[model samples]
Target: MNPILSNLRNITLTYAIWLMIGCLLAALLVLTNISLWANALLFAVPSTLVFGSISASAYYVARSLPMKKRSFFVVAGVFGGTALIYGIIWGILCFFWNKITLLFDESWAGIEMNQHLASLLLICGTLLYLLSILVYDVLLALDNIRQAERREAASEMLARDAELQVLRTQINPHFLFNSLNSISALTTIDAAGARDMTIELAQFFRQTLALSEQQKIALSDEIALCNHFLTIEKIRFGKKLQVQMRIDPDSENCLLPPMLLQPLLENAIKHGIRDLVDGGTIELSSKVRAPWLFVAIDNPVDTQPSSAQGTGTGLKNLQARLRSLYGDKSRVEWRIAEQVFRIEITLPLERS
Candidate 1:
């Protein structure tokens, strides 16, 4: 069934209620040669035709109308068309079946007709048709609004999923590349340490297998993963890399993206401190600032412009992760300042 038609039953009920009103009004003022029964039919017939015509025509307009500004011609066209069509239909019914007009009996069995009564019925039919169409348009507008809201929500969900996919892409390869590099570096150093690093690398892969199963972990867990990540880099770089961490007692309990910090730390080691003979400090801090939690990683600047990459794959991946994990509520900034490279992150205290 058409939604507009399904809605028509309610409109019919309204016409019935208003028909009663029309009957009462007729009883008070109009005293004609017709009986009470004929009088009621006259009013009811015109009311139904007018109401149905207006309601259906208005609903059609609403279904077809655009969300943008509407022209006056559209309103006039629907009202005028409904009035003309239902007026003719109701006029035919009233002119043929009217009992009072047929009451002439033998004088003119079916020859005589009440053109005056037909004209009145036509006028009332036209008026009611226009009125009801306007009412139906209002209902159609409401349905359009609801549909728009659903579409908007669907679009937002799609965009977020795309961002998450991008973040996932960044994370997997950034970690893998570093681990692969470590294995390559380890192949020449202590064979026992190389073997151990491979085992930890395997452990990291096992942890990643559950990524789809879990989107978030406690802040402490992210830190632990970073420690493991650093362990691998430590074996490869040996004593040429130094790690410093300062975690706020309060921030450790909050949930963070599952593998967020490890990538940034890995990036810092790979790009900033690895090539230098004298190692540089890499600092990670978690602190609370009123409504926000700030997790920042600062490392020594790679003052020597090293050209060994197509792009910063780690930065791109981190951007996707930030968008997926915290959306607009979180921010990450990477910059080289005062001979130090820093990646500062701000995430909401979302548990509240």
Candidate 2:
């Protein structure tokens, strides 16, 4: 569709510009003493309007030769040829239209056609057609830019989703392997404990599978999953493993990416508690402060640095996921000081 004709606003604006051009053409005739205002307007305005409507065909011509596909020489040749042809057609129409007006009073109805005036009108017509072609080319370029931006945005979204999926799969299997190994270790010494841990593990996995499919879940739901996870870990580690949560009621309904906090808990236990002869409590806390929701995990670690200390894969993956989902609006930081490994996250407060 011709852009000008596609909507009422463009069509109206195009004709309005052509009307101004028609008045300017008449003024040029009057200034040169070639025709009276009345005679010039009668000939020029309607002729200019009809030619303007015809010029809309230039959109198709410009679109046919896209900017990226055409050479400079090709554009110049095509545009020059089309403008000249349009100018010739316009001149013929003006000549016939003036002759029709001669059937009425010549003084009030028409401009006198002379060699000089005919040549001038032909040039004006050619210039107007060329201008139309240039305008359409600019519109086409803008449309292409918009389309390219949309495509790039969509591609980035797909890549982010794929990365998140891979990370989720990696994290789940890592924990599952560790859990099964713990169960296997218990089978010989205490079959009853192994059976209980296996049952708890099954329940935790069932809940995780349901929530993992969601893009976002309530903080309370995540906390509940973590509690279920802690139950399984307690059965395996016995009295050595403990958890203390101080979650603000206001922050519980806040939404976050699913499986975010639970993995941090797994890391805290595996890296921080496992090596200590007397395991320490994992402190889980959350609070809402205006625009931000803050959560932190603090656990005791062995004073001596050992190979059992984490390689930081889980923390790095958590940071990457936050960056992908929230950009600069979210932050994750971890530090080891005074034999305590603390990980904290800050996110924009979101509900439902």
Candidate 3:
């Protein structure tokens, strides 16, 4: 099927152009003193419209000889042959229609059918068909470019989704191992605390499982998961670990990739608070400023050198995940100064 004929808008536009061409043809006949306005229009308008309908076949001809595969000589031969054939057909139609008008009256005839008039019609028909071929060729080229862009975009999306899945899976195992160890130790000293931690651990893992299947989760849901996580950590660390949350009401419902922040919290505990003699609080704050959501996490690290300093793999991974998800629209940065290690993230705010 012709792409132009496939849509209502395209079909309407095509006919409108052909109507203008018919009017132009009528004007030419009058200007040359070939016929009066009424007679000229009667001869040219209907014939031009019929020619225009047949000219739509130019799309199929252009498709058959695609620009990439066609040779200059072959294209010239094919186009010239079709245009000449259509031109003769159009001249015959005009000649017959002009003669038929005489059946009514001389005033009704748009033009006096003659050899000169027939030649003019043939030339015009050939040129118009060739022009149609050019237009269809350009349209097909643009359509091909658009399709290539769409395919590239889809491929990138699939690759990003695959990377996100790998990142999501990487978030758990080490934390699970540590939690199990904590629970195992607590069982010998405090049976009730161990049972409580067991329950909290179960709930945390259940929530993680639920949210992991999603592409994104609300900030509030992530906070709830973090709270469950903090509970289990508090049980293990006792009074050594403390948390301060300063979350803005507006930012709570903003959505981010699942497990995006939890790994950072795990890193803070494993490297920062656990090293301090009089363990300190981890500060987690978030605020929304119109189109942007800003979040920061700060924890106190020991001044004395320690062997537990991480190789920054988790932070690097977090950065990679941000890049994959948001491209350049999101940012992640971390610095350690004056025994305080802080990581901040900025993201485009998305809400449901």
Every model: Cα RMSD to truth: 6.3, 1.7, 2.1
Order the candidate numbers by lDDT, best to worst: 2, 3, 1
Local accuracy by lDDT, each model = 0.70, 0.91, 0.89
Instruction: For each candidate, give its TM-score against the true structure.
Output: 0.69, 0.94, 0.92
Summarize candidate 2's per-residue lDDT along 236-325 as a digit string, tens digits: 888899899999999999999998988899988888898888998999999999799999999998886468657778888898889889
The window of 10 residues in a row where model 1 has the poorest summed lDDT is 104-113
Q: Residue 255 error for model 3, in Å?
A: 1.8
TM-score for candidate 2, residues paired by index: 0.94
> lDDT (0-100) at residue 242 of candidate 2?
86
Which has the higher TM-score value, candidate number 1 or candidate number 2? 2
TM-score of 3: 0.92
Give per-residue CA lDDT, model 1, range 180-229, as digits (tens).
87788778877888898998888877866775346677787778778887
Q: What lDDT tens digits, residue by residue, belong to model 3 across residues 1-352? A: 6888999999999999999999999999999888889999988899999999999999988888866778989999998899889999999888888878877876756467777778899999999999998899899999999999999999999999999877766667867887898899999998989999999999898878888888889999999988889999898788999999999999999999888788889989989888888899999999999799999999998888598668877888889888998999999988989889999999999995
Better of 2 and 3 by TM-score: 2
The lDDT of model 2 is 0.91
